[model samples]
Target: MMTPATIDPLHTPLCDLLGCEVPVLLAGMGGVARWELAAAVAEAGGYATLGMVREDPALIESEVTALRAATDRPFAVNLIPSATDPALLEAQIRCCLDLGIGAFSFFWDVMPEVIARVKQAGCLVLHQVGTRQAAAEAEQAGVDVLIVQGVEAGGHVHGREAGLDLAVGVHAVSRLPVVIAGGISTGDDLAAALRAGLDGVQCGTAFLATGESFAHDYHKTRVTAATGDDTVLTDVFVLNWPKGAAVRVIGNSVTDALDGRLFGHDPATLPRDAIAWDGDAPRLRFSTDSPLRTTTGDMEAMALFAGQGAGRINDIPPAGVRLRDMAEAARRILAQG
Candidate 1:
């Protein structure tokens, strides 16, 4: 199905390592990459990732089980070094190996235990890096893939501003497949990244708009309705959590109020407890204290994290339909040659 103009043959080291059909990858969108979404991507012939940033040991195992049950295709698990309790991580890794997860996505520096276990389990390691230096270090650490994330990415910014240089950085260091994330939403964007020699594209904003995403309906709708200027990167809300880190989110009344104290805001300024969504329906809102509410519906002033590409989103579709559509579009564009 590859075309002359289409760089479908550009399966770099990571895709080969993970055994995915396309170099394209789902950027482990935290709660958004639930079983349904993950399986859908795999079914559509892309590598799907389940993010376990704030997941508990039991919940992680269950989700992994569900993903495996949904599809026989390969899928990945994303582990956040900061959020994962060491003991809990060990348990989760054991479960991943036991269930035979195809790949493991890492968020921080390659820790020895993580590296050792993942390699021992025969899983490919997809290491995420925010900077070129970190990308090189990850290569040295022996990651099978290098994810070059930019400041335009949702969630954590990783303290880098090289939005345009994301793919360039990855190509500079490792021979592995390089996936460019942050603010990428369209075929044109994907094409541009590939033309820059990137192995593939990993996107969050567009996937977040998919119907299969576990994100609250309110949040999904908001992202779809957002414009180019609707998003802003701020560390204000995320820094308020107990294990707070920097995150990029849309600016809201609550976030706007904290502009003066972006780095200095007291945790008290955020909702003391989780925002109470009245209906059984998901609530989309920015909740510094609750990670679940942040993803699954409840879009009232909640910390709805989205990349700048959110501005380009306009509709919601199921994950399978969306992935197939994108693939078809890419195929068409490539065929033009």
Candidate 2:
């Protein structure tokens, strides 16, 4: 275990608030960040979140129960109100509250009513934003932390700015601590964010490549081999998501088929070709669903979400080891300065 003295440089108020020794946060990637990954990260002293977007209450309850069984450390449940149905979202929140989840993470849009509901239940709220305007709105909505994402982020990018630039801008205006997300995969990235006066970082692609991630092995292998250039920010994978929302995914056969026509492709006009399967359910070619561990069929045709930082990741280690190494490396970098 990393002691406070070893990771002192990387520690921030965010750590104390989130009940973690390190300031790094594992991004709650849907289908990828399950109970196993979340538990591994939390046990490693970094705050973790279970990506429970658009999931059933029973599944949420099961994952939360398993997570609590694995670690007593604090963790958060991630949900997106903009993408989920109102009734299902309400049920998800109720289930989480019943499970006594201490924190919640929301993305995409600022839903004050949802935040207020969680806050009313005495849960801490963390919101990820893409723009300064969104950050301001989230702060006003009573979010405890702001995760400023840049266009370089994988799986549904919300901002047009770069990660560091957006974080700097959001940090200037918000009284709450800010974390940068997008192209943050290495220790240097984390150290640089801290040196820039940001609170911490929220990593998705880095953790998604870890052994504990529920992402399909094919997806993990592709991410490890890909460079920043291999990623394309396109709305090509728009099915099941709000229209106009874009995602950054590694180039695959599906992306190749629509090479020049990456953007503005209407979902209604697209063919409902089933290219993969999650158990018995057929996953459409352009659906927003990424290939999970249980998925089969043409996995390459599925959305393989990865940030520009994919090039820097070369191996799939245990989630706990990966996070611990990152914190220690960041500490060394900070100490040297």
In terms of TM-score, the best-performing candidate is 2
Model 2 gets an lDDT of 0.93
Kindly report which residue stretches of model 1 are placed more than 4 angstroms away from their true locations once superposed: 1-14, 239-244, 265-271, 277-298
Residue range 1-337, candidate 1, lDDT tens digits = 8675555644455566677776678888766788888888888878889977767778888898898888988888998765566787778787777777767888855575667678877778888888887878778777888888888888776746665586686687668778888888877676677668888888887888887788777778888888757776665665323333567777777677764555554444544444445345343333442234234333456777788888778899987777767766666665565
lDDT of 2 at 263: 89
lDDT of 1 at 275: 46
Model 2 CA deviation exceeding 4 Å by range: 1-7
Predicted structure 1: lDDT: 0.72
The global C-alpha lDDT for each of the candidates, from Candidate 1 onward, is 0.72, 0.93
